[model samples]
Structure formats: structure tokens, C-alpha cells
Target: MNEVMDVIRLFLPLIVVQLLLMSVALFDLYRRVSVRGQKWVWVIIIIVINLLGPIAYFIFGREKSSEY
Candidate 1:
């Protein structure tokens, strides 16, 4: 009860940030043409690895382009 509520409150911000990061990562993945690896693989990674997944995609999966 109270303990559960406290735990949720403590982690709420982290959960929100994770959702935000996943959404942004998925949006970028949908729009971009050239990811560093297979699109499906990246999608799995992003959804499965929680916090680190989207960050990994943003840092490593996205291919650098001259237009950037």
C-alpha cells in the first residue's frame, strides 16, 4: 500500500523518461532511411533493453550522413 505507492512515486520519473525516449527513438527510426543495422533488430533492441536500448540506437544505430 504505502510502500508500493512510495516505490511508484520514486520510479515514476524514470518510467516517464523511458517512455519518452522510446517514443522519440521509434519516431526517428520510422523517419530515417539508413540505420546502422536491420530495422527490426533495432526495434527489438529499443523495446527490449529498456533505458539503454533507445540510447544505444540514438548513439550507435543511427547512421551519420552529410545532411546532418
Candidate 2:
């Protein structure tokens, strides 16, 4: 039980961050008009690739806005 707690303590922050990233990615995906790839493909990547998936989506999936 102590070992489980220790492990959880060590990884809990990372898990939380990953969940946050996933949520943000999914929310953005839902709201955006266009992404660099197809919506379903981005969804697959976000759901399947774990931490890197959402990071990749945030970094590369979004199309640049000319308005900015």
C-alpha cells in the first residue's frame, strides 16, 4: 500500500497534466473550424497517443490564423 502511494505520488502530477492537455486538445478540436488534418484523424491522434498526442496537436495541428 505504501509502495502504491509512493508510485501515485510520483506520477500523479504527470497524469493530471496529461488529462488537462487531453481535455484542452479535445475542446479546441471541437471548437475549431479547421485543423492541419482531418477532424477524426486529429481525434484519433489525441486519444491514442497519450501526452504527446495533445502536445503534437497544440504544436502542429492548428492552422495559423491570418487575423493574428
In terms of lDDT, the best-performing candidate is 1
lDDT of 2 by residue, 8-67 (tens): 999999999999999999998998888887999999999999999999998999989732
Candidate 1: 10-residue stretch with minimal lDDT: 59-68
Q: All models: lDDT? A: 0.94, 0.92
lDDT string for model 1 (1-68, tens) is: 99999999999999999999999999899888878989999999999999999999999999887333
Tell me which residue pairs clash in candidate 2: none
Model 2 accuracy (lDDT, Cα): 0.92
Local error of candidate 2 at residue 5 (angstroms): 0.8
Q: What would the TM-scores of all predictions be?
A: 0.93, 0.91
